[model samples]
Target chain A: MPEQLADTVDPANWTCPAPLRDQPVVVMGHGGGGALSAELMEQVFAPAYGNAVLTGLADSAVLELGSARLAFSTDSYVVRPLFFPGGSLGDLAVNGTVNDLAMSGATPAYLSAAFILEEGVELTVVDRIARAMGAAAEAAGVTVATGDTKVVETGHGDGVYVTTAGVGLVPDGVDIRPQRARPGDAVIVSGPIGLHGVAIMSVREGLEFGVEVSSDTAPLADLVAAVLAVTPDVHVLRDPTRGGLAASLNEIARASGTGVRLRERAIPVPDAVANACGFLGLDPLYVANEGRLVAFVPPAAAEEILAAMRAHPQGGGAALIGECVAEHPGMVVVSTGLGGTRVVDLPLGEQLPRIC
Target chain B: MPEQLADTVDPANWTCPAPLRDQPVVVMGHGGGGALSAELMEQVFAPAYGNAVLTGLADSAVLELGSARLAFSTDSYVVRPLFFPGGSLGDLAVNGTVNDLAMSGATPAYLSAAFILEEGVELTVVDRIARAMGAAAEAAGVTVATGDTKVVETGHGDGVYVTTAGVGLVPDGVDIRPQRARPGDAVIVSGPIGLHGVAIMSVREGLEFGVEVSSDTAPLADLVAAVLAVTPDVHVLRDPTRGGLAASLNEIARASGTGVRLRERAIPVPDAVANACGFLGLDPLYVANEGRLVAFVPPAAAEEILAAMRAHPQGGGAALIGECVAEHPGMVVVSTGLGGTRVVDLPLGEQLPRIC
Candidate 1:
């Protein structure tokens, strides 16, 4: 990091918004989807572009545009290695934004891709990435409609960074938002966790576990559509990405002002992922996953939704991992298999950066 | 430049798409929004992701999404020196996307901002930029609805690069596009040209041309609305941005299969801008302007629309500088004062890189 840039920032000039007054310069944590990232959104972006829809701060903003209900979302892919074990940055870029819209009960239709290319990256590499993106978009049933490209001087950027913005049509009569997670809701997770972060780390650090761990990067839009088919009001849905499951749970609890109680043993973590996390001294609960989703459904509809999700190929390992409770509002507590309970706080930063 | 990255590019791997068979690597000209930029879009991107709306290659893709007419556009701003004389990258990002939608005759509504921040950028600099963005969005009557942030490793990124994607509602009965320009249509300019490019060159090179030239980087949506009010049948509206007036004119001529003839004395060029360009061996017609636009109007309604544009403060310097002709289709010719005519070809690349 450049010390000169940090030296130029005066804390007093920030006007010190309450609870986040000390961050005089941006740290890697500010980009992690954890408490620091939330604070950045709340203190900086939320106030600057203050609007009801924006302040809602959902995975996707659901807008009602002139007789059309739309879900809009965006994601930037900055993974270290352009190509990973199970997926490249291309597929991740497509799946990440597509899942964000799916979480809002929308059928994603179109996307805008903007690329920032470093000056001397190989043209063949870009071509390969573009072809992967094309194939991914075809699989997801969306079009890469509009794009812009900018080239930065060499060494001033990583090879290429892609930012994708998407628009989709939200299903009628379905209103899903973070604030709708009530105390009587059942929280179910689709498949295993921690695969994506582990996969990226394996490639980046050149460390291999006994088994090759591949990223679980896939589109969950169809799975979401299945759940919505069973019941329109699914309460809250989120893909555990960047800061992972723990951070996602904490965000929903805070947004709904309710408590989330997770049965630790019920949460499914693949043996490979768990072993890798153990060896690296990282918590599986704080590791990211690209294709998995956590949904909060009313007690009466939980069974049907879980059944629907399990029937889908992407969610064959779906499990009822937890429930929302009224005991400790705005907190998440994990019930240990050892007959003890522990608070699961949001991580200060990601255990691994650029794991998305 | 990283020679290793360049060395990996095999020209044979590209398959040598017709017309663009030569360039093996992405050059700065590919992003210049001129012929090379268009060719890159036509050859590389269009073939990789083939779709109807994308192939149109309009300023903004007009879409019919669930009974709502929408215009989707995106732009990436990599302007060096983050802060310029009259504007920063913040407002440039906001205005650039807004103007793109305005060219499609859309009421600019919402924007998505994604920022790639270098690891050590100062918080104060980011704060100031964010504040300017907020003010610009307010002025343009649009909201920054969603955002994403990523951090690159130090030395692998510029201070910051912003990419904005915007969605707006296109007004009914307005079919403004590049292909709409036709023979005998009057070509009108909204304001003085070349100020933005000169302003950045002045700061980047530390040179002065006897007079300080400030960038005209304000949002032009209001001026567009004023023009559309006079006549909904305006042929085409385009903001002369990256490659300036000459490039935009050539693009329209090629798209509409017509020729453009401009009276040299009628084109508006600020004295300072002309002097600066002359000193730097740059053509005033090819230098960029942020807050300026060119319109193609039917001869019958040209006078009323020109009057309407001149009435707005942003368009106070509006003038009728040229006309579309059937002769020499796909070219732009300027008539000299001595009754001689010379053709103005699209530039191979930008005179100034990262000038926004």
Candidate 2:
């Protein structure tokens, strides 16, 4: 295993950049689920869609209605080929919903799946999907409680598109929000990033490098529970999906109205992912990570939380990637590997073949 | 208005033989959101996906998680042209989600939207879509609480595909389910079917008839609430989306394990919709209806429910179209205008140009 990069990088090498203030209409990078998506949400959606439930910025939203406190979230998985290395559409659909609920500090209980299948899709393919769904539900300890199926003609639909909605219960007294990050908080990543995007891209582009890079699509309920148990002070928790680490950190920064200072040499990057990204002119920071997360915790409890997270099977590589800072409010600055520094701004346009 | 067709027409008046039921995969009919989509769900999905929440067959599913009672549902809207004569993608997405929750007798409270935008999509189109979404949310009295934006390359995605997930609150004792239909129950339709499908088709094909057909893309929360107030015994509530009325009835029959008998003359079809169907060689029963619903209620409360439904703007054309029967378990039979009897089985394939 690669050594943890968290403890070695020096903070003095970092250079901070000015905050990004301009916002654009729906751009390709917004889908990266990274910095771009975060910027769009902060600048456009958050302002227009301001509300207690939305402002929380949890993986899934925790809603309080009457006597009920429920966690609700929706995700649309449009991964091409439906099947890819390490997982299929079924697994992604189920786990994605469960993970969203988990992010809201809830135990995912039920999921509703809606499928838009292209006409002429083979029964065998659908059967495989169904089996995968059943298995995924079992693995996540949630039931496929309800579903809707719509079939479109061949050209109108891709082979299959799955949209899942999940609901869970948030335990009382556990307050988690993106804006809750404090200046003295420590930022830790659950695992290495860029695995999922790399996995998907390899298959789509038919890249033939050895060192198998499978999509890291796994349920994070246990890992989340472990960290939450150590400290509900775990203020901000976001999965680095679509747009990877850069997007997630930027979102946390803006949500808390603060800045993030990162030790570039302290961040973990798999050799295979780094090599692939280098060859493709892609930034690993802006790539997608299905089974990874960034958590902001109170400075005092950071070590305890890190140890607890690392103890969990899914969080074995947990590391402190950065720290919440007070100086450059709502911006992320990183120290380069070569002792230089740069601003990690939100990506502007499309980053195709990055959601592997 | 043209006179309703009799139950028994002369043999010479028969224009086409009954549709074949041997389709191996979905066709345009299935997408019609009418009977064909229903048949596919019943014959394939239902059997393969036998689960408690799914078997209930309600418009929206009422789920019990820990101490919370929540309604969770998901829907994908793949309507062609994205923008139609009466509404746009945003409106359909909002109403579609709201109606799904309303069907479960749940008052919609929050929604999450996920967009898959093609790379080259114009900014103007996206702006219009966003505006439409905001307006639709306001009209439905629901908020777009959370959202995700993803951009696929130009060729990979159709302009834009939207998936909306909604959460609503179900009253303490209300237990609306599709399988709850019993003998001596009356079937009521909110309004005419096939309008949405026909409207979309008209725009796509550039067909201009004397009376233009526009989609009835309206929310049905008020109608649902009014009817539920009168009788929580509303056994089954469904929106005849892709497979239209024929599919909705068939699904109810199969789920309730009872037979459904309908009078062709009692069913309401707008003159313009009927003309469109005739010109296109389609059966109105198998077309889609976006802003309509089919409700099964106890015979004693049918009149009251119909009156209450008609009071709502979206349900002004509400009418009693059928009744549950003890015979022909798992089947739906209709009396043709020609005075001949035919089995209205679930459509075996797609019915193109439908969104319900």
Candidate 3:
């Protein structure tokens, strides 16, 4: 019977998709969550896992199970040096998926933690990561409901790679997805950007700014709840993690077939993070942010939502960074500080790989 | 802040749980799903992720969601060589979690796949695996709802490691858990055992029996559904993947506080698998099996369920293997082929590691 199953898949006769034809082997960029990442999905994963829910390409796939609307999402953390400036892989493992569910306006509820460990990993190290995850889950008001652990030979793996899958209840009447972004919607960010990517790069490159930049690895569930309280008609919500703000905006624009127009001065970038990115020749817009979200909402309710975001502790620095435009579908245009407009594109690959 | 969250978990003052105290570092046996696996869970995972639902230690944690009972489980496939005689990692990835959800008496619904791939792996190889997963999911009647891909440096990972988390819906009036096993319950196995473990070992050890051996890596969800039609009061069900039939019986006995009495001659082991195990000095009872199940049901309904199982293509070799007893609680007793009896204890560690 196994052979019968094998007969269905003729790998030898399968044709390579055009975008992926040149790249015969997977590169680090394919996992970078940028243009290459999109190519991989369109060429490889979409054909394999094409479904109404998954093709939506949201952070979480919202499904109706019985009478409940559930949001499910998954992420794997391969961050180097388990511990970072302010957060560890444990925090990323929990908060990353929690934030993904939050983007769907779901009440983050349960998580499954699966770890792939290399042989010879100290139990104490894993213990620390687990406890950190426990604390994060507690902070986010979720439970780690199931877990699995697999150990590979010492040479087959790095220290530890954690994969976390989350299930949250998407409240009724809340339909937040990247594809819902529309022209004339306001673009807002919850807080400052680039700190997380800078913090990780600082550690990896052994470079120090005048002031240290720590990861903004906080759970955004509460902040998202606050936003939902203001309005259920929110169009899109995205957590810019891997490919950063640029990739998030470009993806939203592409998904919604709209253009994005941003004011350069309106975007918040902390001095330390700005200096770090400048020194590293990295764009703050393309640098990742762990505890931040970009929202697309009706222009009418934008100010009220911005006020609500500003009142919350995690979103105190929230601002209206841009607006969706009717021109140049699937493009992002930023007005420079000098009054010149330039196009912004998703990075070919993330400069800082495995930051999250 | 991240620091405030860190303040709660004082890693410096945290004490290592006693069961894990001696093993300061992870070993291959910890992932073996036997004694070491149990110890790691009880000591490490339980303390870190202890919740009412997870402490049950069922294959899939059953959660009560709005108007429905949901079952969720996670397993990561790190089986070496990617492909073997009968199955690939893709088949195992899809079937493994589906079987886990099936053990909970649930209709497997959705799966999330997270891949950890090493850089420089061929795209065609990944394509083959993805297509295989697609075919398997289609055959199993589940969707790959969401997915994530991460790339580690070449030396930091094997070719590809896939972690699959599944969600299923437990039907009304169908309750199944290992602890539900009762003293009068009868034990039945769906089909032949030890084929999967032997198949992998044969390839790894470069040994062959006179006849070819192939892995029995098929989804058991449908077979489980067929058995459920016979009776809804199934006491316990397990796939016996990593630690095999002996471990499954032993765990059931321990969980239910009952003794398991098996007739050695009734258990099915294919000739090639038995021959291969004998040549390798391996115990067939400790070998892995996919696409199979060991069920504990009321003795009155055992014959009907066995007939139902035998009629199904996947369960053609089904047989009544054993029964549960009150005497020698928490132990497994087997009557030998020579008319002697012996206690079958959970192995200190599984003989075959990563066989799943």
Candidate 4:
């Protein structure tokens, strides 16, 4: 990892392809899942890994094998400060991918966990992480069926980095993706927003807002199932994780060719999170959340779906926040509480780095 | 990643559970897929993530989701030097996982790739790796369906690390596991061993054996399918990777409560790899191979299966190495080329570290 170390790899053997001239090197924003992340995928990954399922770029890929259809997803948790207030890296590792599959209306059944450990990491820490993953998978009613472990020399890794990939069963009648959003579809959020990002930031920056803010990193498969039980025709579902609510909305708008109009007043942001964001000059809508989900459904079934989500433990704060519109396609406009309309473009990168 | 850095985590929040008292801290051997690796799983991972499927400790887990029978597996590639003589990390990532599913008697259909990047790494290098993955997946007949990317601060990573998880369809009546290796089963290995381990070590140690030794890393799903075409009743299929041929044979012997008798003279070992291991004081028997597979099949169908395997491009070097015996259950004994018998116990760890 040090420059002085001599190794066989030249590190300059392969030059960047012509298409990647804009960014000769990778920046932090490239991993932000925002505009930069999109460009990276479109130019680099999507072109190299050309396939319909990957081209769609949804949270989870629905694949058909033989006579079965299943949802598969992958996520690597690289959150700074391995342990946060309400959760640890292990919690995010399991819940994040499970939630991705859940967002596709798939009943998450199994997960594959691969761990990259630093050479000198304490075994106790890894044990704790594994226990946390076990508990989370149990809560989500999924099995951690297969795994691989690799260790890098000290200073070459950030203690422990876990990449988990999961597979789930998608029901026959259910079809969901970001592109399913349509005009007039009502958008509802599962619960309070911005808790996860704020929690990581508070612990990272050592700034307290009088009250403790913990991450809302809980598994939401149950919440998703409850919502699906109410209606299988749900248009779209997204878990606002890395780039948060604004990013998800922007992607949906662009993919579906629909404009999104949000009622900022209806969006639920706890007072503590609001105060923290105010003090930090951060927008909660652009902040990340782990255990929350955004659902777009036909307006007719929105109320019932909202009711079902609210009844679930993971979605106690469900609220109807917006609706898809035909005007200003590929744009998201918010009607602020201050009685002004604001366009919410996807941030070039996430406000908080490594806030997963 | 430096200790002086101010972070929220204390790194001492959790204590090692009672069961892991033997190894107070994780070492490189825990990832070696040998004795230490097995101990970690049995003592730490298995207890925490308790499930029947996980307890089996197979290369891939076969699950029944609804009416679908599928195989799920995961692997992380942290091989140092990034690029090697014959292949790169990207090729290893895809082929490793695909071969795992194929060993489970499944047809690899899709893969999920997650990358952890070190900030400031060249995007061109990333593009090359992605292209390599695309080509490997194409050769393996699998789609790169879903993926995630995260970047850590410059010093917290080794340029690029890839973790790929794959899911594939398991044909009806196909059951393959290490525990299925029984007495009277013929042991056949596809292609030469030790090439991959020697290739990696040559680059890492700056050793040259007059002749170039390239890694024998290739996709083996088609070869596995060819074997299956001859017969689905094959007892065990193992793609010797991290722990190499010796480790795999030991595991199969222990798992099935049978003894493995090998004719060392018949086990294919290229002269270059043999000479390299000789100079390095390494055992070619414990060296790794990426594209090779060791099959345990009934003696009745061994010839036909061998013929089918030899007919495939990936299995041109296929040779019958040995057979399972009831004499020394849970042990492996090899008859050497020098007309002497040698007991091959699993190495406590691996001779080559971070090798695929």
User: Best-fitting candidate, measured by DockQ?
Assistant: 4
What does the lDDT come to for candidate 3? Answer: 0.86
TM-score of each candidate's B chain against the true B chain = 0.93, 0.87, 0.93, 0.93
The positional error of residue B172 in candidate 3, measured at the CA in angstroms, is 0.9
DockQ of 1: 0.59
DockQ of each: 0.59, 0.42, 0.61, 0.68
CA shift at A96, candidate 4, in angstroms?
Answer: 0.5
Segments of candidate 2 deviating more than 4 angstroms: A1-27, A34-58, A153-157, A208-210, A278-283, A335-341, A349-351, A354-356, B1-50, B336-340, B354-356
Q: Which residues of candidate 4, in runs, are more than 4 Å off? A: A1-21, B1-23
Cα distance off (Å), candidate 2, residue B57: 2.9
lDDT of 2 by residue, B221-278 (tens): 8888899889787888888876678778877887788889999999998898888888
Candidate 2 residue lDDT tens string, A106-195: 888888777777777775676677778878888878888767776665665667777788877877777777788878889899888788
Model 3 per-residue lDDT at B163: 92
Better of 1 and 2 by TM-score: 1
| Model 4 chain B weakest 10-residue run by lDDT | B1-10
**What is the overall TM-score of model 3 with all chains considered together?**
0.94
- By summed lDDT, which 10 consecutive residues of candidate 3 chain A come out lowest? A1-10
Alpha carbon lDDT of residue B349, candidate 2? 44
Q: Residue by residue across A83-134, what tens digits does model 1's lDDT show?
A: 9999999899899999999989899988988888877677777777777788
For model 4, report the TM-score of its A chain. Answer: 0.93
Task: Give the per-residue lDDT digits (tens) of candidate 3, residues B32-104.
Answer: 8776777788878778865667667688999876677999999888998789988999999999999999999
lDDT of 3 by residue, A126-237 (tens): 8999989999999999999988888899988988899999998988899999889998999999999998999998888888998788999999999999999999999999
Residue A317 in model 2: lDDT: 93
